[model samples]
Target: MSRVVSRGLSAASGMLGGALAGAIFKQVWKLASGKEEAPQATSEEYGWREVLVAAAVQGAIFGMVKAAIDRSAAQSIHRATGK
Candidate 1:
């Protein structure tokens, strides 16, 4: 039962983490690149460098946020269940 509950919590937190990461990425991108929005790959105005850099930064932010959220959820479950 606890395992099921933990899995559910983890899934929910993963979604929340994604949303949080997106907002953070936007702000970081704006500050770093002076652009309100990151360039899309299909945008002819942006070259490969801009698109690739944005992708890398976004991926790093998302990965870190997901890891932090998952770790926190696991620790909470462990503390509650002693498992």
Candidate 2:
């Protein structure tokens, strides 16, 4: 069904976005805290392992946040619709 496919795609997109945000957030945190000594390099200089780990963390955070947001949004919409 198109609905099922759309749901799957939405989930995949959410995970990917979360992972990307997490990785960037991790890198930015490092840079901001002065933990990273060298200037930032391009993606070619960054390894996959670091990115994967960051993405995992980010995905988890995003998942939790997304759940809360969805719940609240659903509740608000339901109330508006008198459902």
Candidate 3:
């Protein structure tokens, strides 16, 4: 209920959400590409198009997860503090 506790909860939620998003992305990429490994933007083996696409997908997933987690945390904090 305190500010410290609320911030701590938000931080923890963000970490958990990021990890979940990464795992989800890996599974999604595997299914979509039929490959075990996702393309890396810095890797020399992958073409520019492949690398860019991978980066875009990864960014989108991370952004969505972060936003969702942040929103949920904010709502929960508001309910707890009535502020």
Candidate 4:
């Protein structure tokens, strides 16, 4: 496949992963804190403080996982090319 297609797939995968991570993290936090499980009305409703805190934690974890998968994929490509 072309590099453009590969990049697009990678991007879509990363975005999906990030969104899933964020949702799971938010729910887990709410559950652990004994808070209600209802979804917020808007991103702003959570406020920057809570949003940023959750975002940072979830983003870091998701970023690491995404990077690992990307790195492994690159390695496989390199190995296939005998590089």
Candidate 5:
């Protein structure tokens, strides 16, 4: 039962983390690049360096946010159910 609860919580948190990560990445990119949007891979204006840098930054933020959210959820589940 606790496992099922944790799975559900994890799923929900994953979605939230993705959204939070996207927002954070957008703000960071704006500050770093002075641009409102990150370059798409197909965008001709941005070279490989810009695109790769954006990708790396976005991935790092998403990974960190997911880890933090997952850890928080796990802690909450343990506190609630002693699991």
Candidate 6:
């Protein structure tokens, strides 16, 4: 595969991974908190602990998803090009 094609696939995979992560986080948050909406970090209604926890969880999920997608994309490119 060409470099352009590989880059395109990587970009597409990253976007899809981000979307998947967001959906997963939303569902997990709902299940864990029993609330449909997650607490905002800047909102006064939520305590600092709750806000920090939500931020941490979301950040972790996003990082993991991005890493996984990036690694998968690189492997796919390597396999296709043998380089």
**Most lDDT-accurate candidate:** 1
The Cα local distance difference test for each model comes to 0.93, 0.61, 0.86, 0.68, 0.91, 0.87
Model 6 Cα lDDT, one tens digit per residue, 1-83: 57687688777887899899999999989988898878997789999998888889899999998988888877876797798
TM-score, cand. 3 vs. native: 0.90
Badly placed stretches (over 4 Å) of model 4 are 1-47
Model 4 clash pairs are none
Per-residue CA lDDT of model 4 for 5-50, tens digit only, reads 7799788877876777667666766775566543343655676666
Candidate 5 per-residue lDDT over residues 1-83, each given as its tens digit: 86697688778888889999999999999999999999999999999999999999999999999889878877887798798
Q: How accurate is candidate 6 locally (lDDT)?
A: 0.87
Model 3 misplaced regions, further than 4 Å: none
TM-score per model over all chains: 0.92, 0.44, 0.90, 0.52, 0.90, 0.88
Backbone N/Cα/C clashes per model: 0, 0, 0, 0, 0, 0
lDDT per residue for candidate 3 within 1-83, as digits (tens), equals 57788788877888899899999899988988888899876789989988788788989999999998888877887897798
Q: Please give the range of 10 consecutive residues that has the lowest summed lDDT in model 3.
A: 1-10
Candidate 1 wrong stretches, greater than 4 Å: none
Candidate 5 colliding pairs: none
> How far in Å is the alpha carbon of 55 misplaced in model 4?
1.6
Worst 10 residues of 2 by lDDT: 33-42
**Candidate 5 regions off by >4 Å?**
1-3
Order the candidate numbers by lDDT, best to worst.
Answer: 1, 5, 6, 3, 4, 2
Minimum summed lDDT over a 10-residue window in model 1 is located at: 2-11
TM-score top scorer? 1
Worst 10 residues of 4 by lDDT: 32-41
Q: Per-residue CA lDDT of candidate 2, range 1-83, in tens?
A: 85696577568756766666566666765764455532243466657765565556556666776676567655875686676
As for model 1, its CA RMSD to the true structure in angstroms is 1.1
Can you give the lDDT of residue 61 in candidate 4?
Answer: 67
